[model samples]
Target chain A: MTAEKLQVAFTDILKAHQRISPYIHKTPVFKNSKINDLVHRELYFKAENLQKTGSFKARGALNAVLQLKEKQTNLKGVVTHSSGNHGQATAWAARTTGLQCSIVVPSYSPAVKMEAIKEYGAELVECGPLPTDRNAACEKIAAEKKYEMIPPFDHYHVIAGQGTIAVEFLEAVPNLDAILVPISGGGMIAGIAVAAKHIKPNIKVYAVEPEGKILEKSLRAEEMLWPNPPQYLNTIADGIRLQQTGHLTWPFLLQLVEKEVFTVNNEEIIKAMKFVFQRMKLVIEAASGAAVAAAMSDQLQKLDKKIQHIGVILCGGNVDIDKLPWF
Target chain B: MTAEKLQVAFTDILKAHQRISPYIHKTPVFKNSKINDLVHRELYFKAENLQKTGSFKARGALNAVLQLKEKQTNLKGVVTHSSGNHGQATAWAARTTGLQCSIVVPSYSPAVKMEAIKEYGAELVECGPLPTDRNAACEKIAAEKKYEMIPPFDHYHVIAGQGTIAVEFLEAVPNLDAILVPISGGGMIAGIAVAAKHIKPNIKVYAVEPEGKILEKSLRAEEMLWPNPPQYLNTIADGIRLQQTGHLTWPFLLQLVEKEVFTVNNEEIIKAMKFVFQRMKLVIEAASGAAVAAAMSDQLQKLDKKIQHIGVILCGGNVDIDKLPWF
Candidate 1:
C-alpha cells in the first residue's frame, strides 16, 4: 500500500475525538513523584485502564460503530473475531449504539473473557482455536447477516478512533517530550504517533512490544515478517500477540512510528504491573505493563537525558484475578 | 469525658484543610454505574487510597504535626504507635516538615509495613505485639526525647485533620444523603461525622466496622467497650483492629454520628475488595472494603430506599501483594 492511500490525517483524529466524545471516557492522566524519581524523568500515565470497557479498544470500537451508524441508514449489526479487550470493546460499543453485535472467539478462549463479551450483550460464536478459523467464522457471519465487520486494528475508522487518545493525552500534558505506547497490530501506536506528531511535530512516539514479537524485525526488514503464532508467541501479554501488523497499519507505522520498536521481557512486564499496583494504586493488565516497562528500560537511557517529560499509555486493566502471575 | 471538652468545631476542620492543602491530595470522588445499580443507590467513592502516603491517615498526621510545629518552639519530634497506614503517614508528615518522627510498631508487624515507615525517614521502635506495649513504648520515647505525642485517632488535631475528608467529599458531592466510613479507633468516622453533619446538618454519617468488633456494641451501650484483641479481633481488616475507640473521638461519635454502626463479615469484605479491583480498577485494602461492603450489604436495605446518594470512603490501598486474601 502506498503512503498516500494509507495516510491517516490529523483532521481524521480530531474528527474522531469530536464524534466519540460522548461515548468514550477521556481517561485521567496520573503522575507519581516516586516514579519520576526512579525514572529520572517526569512521567505522565494516560490511564486508559480505567476507561470504559477497561481498555483503549473502547475508543476505536465506539468510533467505528458510531461511524458505521452514520454511514449506514439501516445498520443491521457489527461482527468481530477476538477473545480480548477488542471483543469486549466492540460488544460494549454495539450495546451503547443500540446495534446487534456478534463476537467469534476460539473454543479454547478463557471462560472469563468469553463471559465478559456475553455480559456486554454480544452474540458469542465459538470457532476453532486458530486465527484462520476465527477469521473465516467472522467472514461467514458478516456475509450471512450483512453486519459491518469492524477489523480490530487495520481499518481507517478504527485507527482514527484510536488516535483520539493522543489528542486527549497531549491536551492534558501539552509539553510531553515523548509518548510510549504498546504495539499489537500497530493500530493504537499508529494512531497515537500520527496524532502526537501532528499536534507537536518534534514530539517523539515510541512503540513498545513484548519480547519475541517480530514487529521490530519487520520494521528493520522494511517488509512484513509474519511469525508463526503458536511457535513465536511466548509472551504473557496476550493483548499484543499478533503475528504481523495489519496491511493498512504497517504503512502508517513505517512512516509514523520511531525507527526502533522497544521490546520488554515478561519478567519486566510483571515487575512493571506490580509497581503500578503497589505505588500508583492502579490495577493494570500485562499489556499496559509493556509500555511502562519500555519507558523504564535501559533502551530509554539516551532519551531520558534529552526528554524531561514522558507519557506512557496504560492501555488496559482487565486481568483475570485468579490467573495473576504472582499467584 | 464531657462532650464540651472533646468537641471538634467545624472551623477546626476548615483550618486543618487549609494547613494540609499543600501536603495532601484532595483525592477524586469516583462513581461507577455498575456499583450504583448493584446497591440501588448512587454511590460516590472518595478514593483516599490514591491519596498521598496511600491513605486518609496522611491528612490527620500532617494536621497534627503541623499543629505541633506551630504551637511549640522547641519541637524535638513526634511519636506514634501504629503498625499500619498511620505509622507511614506520621513518618511522611514529619519528613515533609523536616522534623524527627518515631514510630513504635509491634515486633510482629509486617516487614513491608516497617520498610515503608523507615523509607519516610522515621525512627522505628519495635515493641511487643500488644496495644499496651506499643503505647508504653511510644510514651517512653515521647518522655525521653520531649517529642509531642501524636495519637492515631484521639487528639483534637487528628480528629480535625481527618474531618477534612468530609469537607472535601461534601464539596464534591454536596447532596449525599449519607456517608459511610470504616471505623478503627473511631477517629476517621468521628471527624467525618462532625464535618459532614456540620456542613449538611441533616446528612447521616454511618460507621462501618468488621464483624465481632465492639464499636457497634459500644455505640449501643452508650459507653466505651474495649474488646480483647486476641480473642475478639479475628477480621482480615488489620488496619481497623483497634480494641477501643479513642477518648476524644468517642464524644464526637456520640453526638455527630448516627445511632447505629454497620458491620460486615470478613467474607463480605473480601468480596467487596475483589469487586473494586475488578470493576472500579482500584486496589483497596480490607479496611476500605469494610465501607464498600457496608454500602452494598443487606443492612443498607431500608437506607437504600431513603438515601438516593451515598458516599463511601475508600480508606487505604497499602496491601502486601503476597498476603492478598484472594490469592
Candidate 2:
C-alpha cells in the first residue's frame, strides 16, 4: 500500500473517534504505585479491560458497523469470525444498530465464548480450524446471503475505531515518552501507532507479543509475513497468538511502530498477571499481561530506566472462569 | 451501647472521614448493565475493591493511625493481628505515615500477603490461627514496647474510618435506597450502617455473611460470640470468614443494621466471582462476591424491588492468585 493510503486510514481514525465517542467508554486511566517502584518509572494503564464488552474490540466493531455507508446499505447482515471478544463485540454492534449478525467460528472454540456470543443474540456459523476454510466459508456466506463481511482486523473503519485509543491517550497524558501495546492481527497497535505518532512526532510506539507468537519477527525482518510457518500457535496470550497480521494492518505497523518486543513464556505472562493483580489490583487479560510483562522484564533493556513515563493499554479482560489457570 | 452512645459514634465517623480523606482513595462508583438486568434494580458498586491497598481497610487503618492523639505520642509502634487485608492495610498505613508497624499474622497466612507486609516495611509476627491467641500476643508486645494496639474492628477509630465508605457513597449517590455490606468482624457494616442510617433514616442497611460462619446468628441472638464454628475455614471467601465479631462492633451493629443475610457454599461465591469478573469486568475479592451473590439470590427476601437504587461496597480485591477459584 502507498503512503497516501496509510494517510487516509489515519484520517478515517480521526473521524472514527468523532463518530463513536457517544457510544464508547472513555474508560479510566490508572498509575500503579506498587508497580511504579519496581519499574522505576511512572506507568500509566489505559483500562480498556474495563471497557464495554470487556475489550477494545467494541471500539473497532462499532466503528466498522457505523461507518458502512449508502453503497453498503443493502447489507443483508454482518458476519465475522472470532473465538470470543470480537464475536461479542460484533453481536453488540449489530444489536445496537438494528442489524442481524452471523459470527463464523471454529467448531473447537471455547464453550464459554460461544455462550457469550449466544447471549448477545448472534447467529453462529461453526466451521473448521483453518483460517483459510473459515475465511472462504464466511466469504461464500456473505456472497450468497448478501451479508457484509466484517473483517476483524483487515478493514479501514475497524482500524480507525481502534485508533481512537491514541486520541484518548494523548488527551489523557499528552507527553507520554512511549506506549507499549499488545499485537495480534495488528489492528489495535497499528491504529494506535499511526494516530499517536502523527499527533506527537517524537512519541515512541512499541508492540509487545507473546514469546511463541512473535509478530515482531515479521515487522523487524521488513517482510509482510509471519516468522515461522503458518501452523505455529502456542501461547497463553490467546488474543495475540495470531499466525499472521491482516493485509490492512501490516503497512501501517511497519511505517509507524518504533520498536516491537517479545515477552517471555506463558509463565512470565502468568507472573505479570499475578503481579498486577496483587500489586495494582487490576484484572488484566493475558494479552494485556504480555505488554506489562515486557515492560517489567528486561526485554526493554535500554529504555527501562530512561523513559520518564510510559503507557500500556490493557486490551481486554474476557478470560473464561473455568479456564482460568489459578483454579 | 446506648442510642446516645451510637450518636457519639456517628460523630466520630464524621471526624474519621475528615481524617482519612487525604490518605485514602475516594474510589469511583461503577454500574454494570448486565448486573442491573439480573438484580431488577439499578446497582451501583462503590468500588472499595479498587481502593488503596485493594480494600476499604485502608480508610480504617489510616483513620486509626491519624486519630492517635498527643497522649499517644510516646507510641513506639502500632500492633494489629490479621491474616490478610487488615494486615496489609496496617502495614501500608504505617509506612505512609512514618510509624512502625508490627503485624501479628497467623502462621498459615499466605506468603503473598506476608510479602506485601514486608514490602511496606512492617515487622511481621507469626502467631497461631485463633484471633484470641494473636490478639493476646499483640497486646503483650504492645505492653512491652509501649506500642498502641489497633484492633481490626470494635475500636472506635477503626469503625469510624470504615464509616467513610457510607459517607462517600451517600455523598456520591445521594438517592441510594439501600446499602448492602459484607459483614466480617462487623467493623465495615457497623461503621457504614451507623453513617448511612444517621444521614438518611430511611436508607436500609443489610449485612451479608457466608452461611457456614454465623456471625449474623450472634447478631440476631444479641450476643458478642462466634457461631457455627468452622471445622476449618473451607469457603473460598476467606476475607469474610472471620471467627468472630468485635465486642464494640456487635453493639453498634445491633442498633444500626436494618437486616442481616447469609449465603452458603463455595459454589455461590465462586459463581458470583465469575459473574462479577465476566459481566462487570471488575476484580473483586470473595467478600465482594458474597455481597453480589446475596444481591442476586434474593438472600434478603424481605426487601422489595421498590428499593430501586442500591449500592454495594465491593469491599476488597486482595485474593491470592493461587487461591483464586477462577485463577
Deviation (Å) of B85 in candidate 2: 1.4
Cα deviation at B294, candidate 1, in Å, is: 1.2
Residue B180 in model 1: lDDT: 91
Q: Give the alpha carbon lDDT tens digit for every residue of B1-327 in model 1.
A: 555655788999999999999978889898888888787889999999999989999999999999999989689799999878999999999999989999999898889999989989999999996668987999999999999888888888999999999999999999999999998888898889888988899899998988777576777777877744533368899888765777778888887787787889999999999999988889899999999999889989767477889999999999887678988
> Compared with the true structure, what per-residue lDDT tens digits does model 1 show for residues A75-99?
9899999899999999999999999
Candidate 1: stretches off by over 4 Å: A1-6, A227-232, B1-6, B227-232
lDDT of 1: 0.88
Give candidate 1's error at residue A128 in angstroms. Answer: 0.8
True contacts kept of 1: 0.64
Native contacts present in each candidate (fraction): 0.64, 0.67
Question: How far off is residue A127 in model 1, in Å?
Answer: 0.6
TM-score of 2: 0.92
- Candidate DockQ scores, in order: 0.75, 0.53
Per-residue lDDT tens digits for candidate 2, residues A87-132, read 8898888877788888999999888889888878889899998878
**TM-score of predicted structure 1:** 0.96
